[model samples]
Target chain A: NAGVTQTPKFRVLKTGQSMTLLCAQDMNHEYMYWYRQDPGMGLRLIHYSVGEGTTAKGEVPDGYNVSRLKKQNFLLGLESAAPSQTSVYFCASSSRWREGVNEQFFGPGTRLTVL
Target chain B: AQSVAQPEDQVNVAEGNPLTVKCTYSVSGNPYLFWYVQYPNRGLQFLLKYITGDNLVKGSYGFEAEFNKSQTSFHLKKPSALVSDSALYFCAVRESTSNTGKLIFGQGTTLQVKP
Candidate 1:
């Protein structure tokens, strides 16, 4: 299986620009998440969906929004780019907690730079 | 609030010698701990997880972590280090009461193995 894949491996944007990141997983997971990785800081959860059509805010969700229109796909959107949002973004998926706190599978990550 | 901490920003070790990565966690109830590794320009990869039963959890790439409830620690260890093992390591924790399976991640620790 391809596991999880992210589109737009690299991007550069100016302030006030907008973009969307695409994440797709073939594992049929029930949960999906978006996170950003900055130097010296570990990955922080941006948003997550418990299932299709359900999304919720996470630890760092101020500049980001997300949607899970399909069970296998999760999308993260930046309404207006900011320098603080420039970081490596990652998407992950995992089974439900009832399945025993399963480890999340991550994508290759998208490197974004906002000027 | 649930949280994880990696006190060391970086750790240097010689190849063929044992290595340990320290991690500590805080949570109200039982904690589900995990370790992940990130190679340069790559997404984070799951290393190991501690849920229940055995205190010593073995994972991919000859890595093992011991869960110490008394100390609220889960330290990653390998019998012998390899230059290839050099990477950034993250420690994460999820509260057992959380149904969404949200994880709190540490700041990450860089492991540098010299030949």
Candidate 2:
């Protein structure tokens, strides 16, 4: 089903440079999330969408923005990239709001390095 | 705020031996706990989760976890370890007042299964 896929497996950005990460899922999930994984830090949610045309802030949403204009796609944007934003970013999707039974399906991940 | 703790930084076990990865969490109410595995340079994959019902929850890759509500712990276990089982393990918890279903992850535990 292709499950979840992310564009640009790796990226390097200069400080102040802006960029967008694209995440697409073919599973028709109702929920999508953006998370960053730093060494020793498992994963931290940056933003999420409950459904199309909806977005919400997560635990660490300071430097990131997100949009879910379509049901199968979620995009994360960095207005001004910073060194602190260097990390592996993962995109995930779930069928519904409830977890456990509806565990998330993650993308291969996009590694970003901001200098 | 919900949080997850994976006490051990790393765990090593020989092939054919049983393996255990400890996890604990803190949340206001009932928590939806999850365990995920990540291979080198890859995104996390769902392993199992504990939401309700039985304390013993069985999941993928022949792994199981026992959820202890009183102790507030969910430990992942496998009867026989394999070299393929060597990877990074993450524990996560979901608790939301906004009902976004965002997840908070632990620092991660490295599992090394030697053959």
Candidate 3:
């Protein structure tokens, strides 16, 4: 299985440009998440979806929006990209939300450079 | 709020020697801890997790982690280090109180195994 896959491995955007990062999971997971990784900040959650048609803001969801139109797809959108938004974005999915037993599977990551 | 911390930025160990990457967490209720590994330019891979049963939990790539409830620690360990195991390790946790299903991650620790 492809597990979790992200579109556009790398992209460059000018200030104020908008784009969407697509995440697809074939594992039939019920929970999906979007996180941004900075040099020393580790991974910070931006938005998450518990199931299809359900989305919620996370720790760093201020400049981002997300939609889970289908169970296998979660899309992260940057309405007006800023230089501060330049970072590596990762998508992950999990089958459960109970506890340590539910391990998250991550995508290869999308490197975004907002110039 | 649930949070995780990885004290060391990097850990160096010789081949054939035991290695450890320390982690600590904070949560209101029962904590669910997890460890993940990331190779250069790749996505994070699941290692092991501590749910309920045993304090010591085994995971992929011959790695294990000890979960200490009193100390709120989950340290990743390996019996013998391998050069191939050199990578970035992350400690993560989720609070059992809320059902939002968001993960809190620590600043990653880079593991350097010298041959």
Candidate 4:
């Protein structure tokens, strides 16, 4: 199964331009997350969804929005891209927390560059 | 607030020598700690996790981590380092009380194994 897949492996956007990143997972996971990886800064959560139709802010949720309208898909949107937003974005999914599974599965990241 | 820290920005070791990557975390409750490795231009790969049971947890690619509650540290270690092990390592923690399964990541540590 394609554990997780991200659309547009690489993208370049101009300041003020907007775009949405799509993440799809076939593992039927109940939890999905969006994170940005900057050099040396590791991966910081931008947003996450516990289940369908639910979303919550994360450590660095500013300048980003997310939607989980379906059980298998999570989308991250940038309303107005900025140079500081340029980084490698990752999508991950995992089973429910109480099920004894705590490891998250990540997809190939999407590298974004905003000028 | 939950947080994780990787004290070293980079670690260098000779091939076939023992290697260690230090990590420490803070959380309101019990912490579910994890380690992930990322190759250049690739997504993060899960290495190991410490949830409960033995303090020494073994995981993928011959990596293991020791969870020290008193020290509040979970350091990744390998018996012998390989050149292929040169990559970026990250430590993360999730509070047991968090139903949302959110994780706080540390600034990554670069591991350089010289052949």
True contacts kept of each: 0.83, 0.69, 0.73, 0.77
| Model 2 lDDT per residue over B1-115, tens place | 6778999999999999999999999999888889999999887899998878899999999999999999999999999999999999999888744366678899999999998
* Inter-residue clash pairs, candidate 4: none
Q: How does residue B79 of candidate 2 score in lDDT? A: 99
DockQ of each: 0.88, 0.69, 0.74, 0.79
TM-score of chain A of each: 0.98, 0.96, 0.96, 0.98
lDDT of candidate 4 at residue A1, scale 0 to 100: 93
* Local error of candidate 4 at residue B101 (angstroms): 1.0
**What TM-score goes with each of the models?**
0.99, 0.95, 0.97, 0.98
Candidate 3 local accuracy as lDDT?
0.93
Off by over 4 Å in 4: none
Interface C-alpha root-mean-square deviation, candidates in order: 0.7, 1.6, 1.3, 1.0
User: Which of the two, 2 or 4, has more DockQ?
Assistant: 4
Categorize the docking of model 1. Answer: high
Ranking by TM-score: 1, 4, 3, 2
Between which residue pairs do clashes occur in model 3? Answer: none
Q: Candidate 4, residues B1-115: lDDT per residue as tens digits?
A: 7889999999999999999999999998988999999998888899999989999999999999999999999999999999999999999999998887788899999999999
Q: Output the number of the lDDT-best candidate.
A: 1
Comparison by lDDT, 1 against 3, better one: 1
Ranking by lDDT: 1, 4, 3, 2
| Candidate 3 DockQ vs. native | 0.74
Quote the positional error of residue B105 for candidate 2 in Å: 1.0
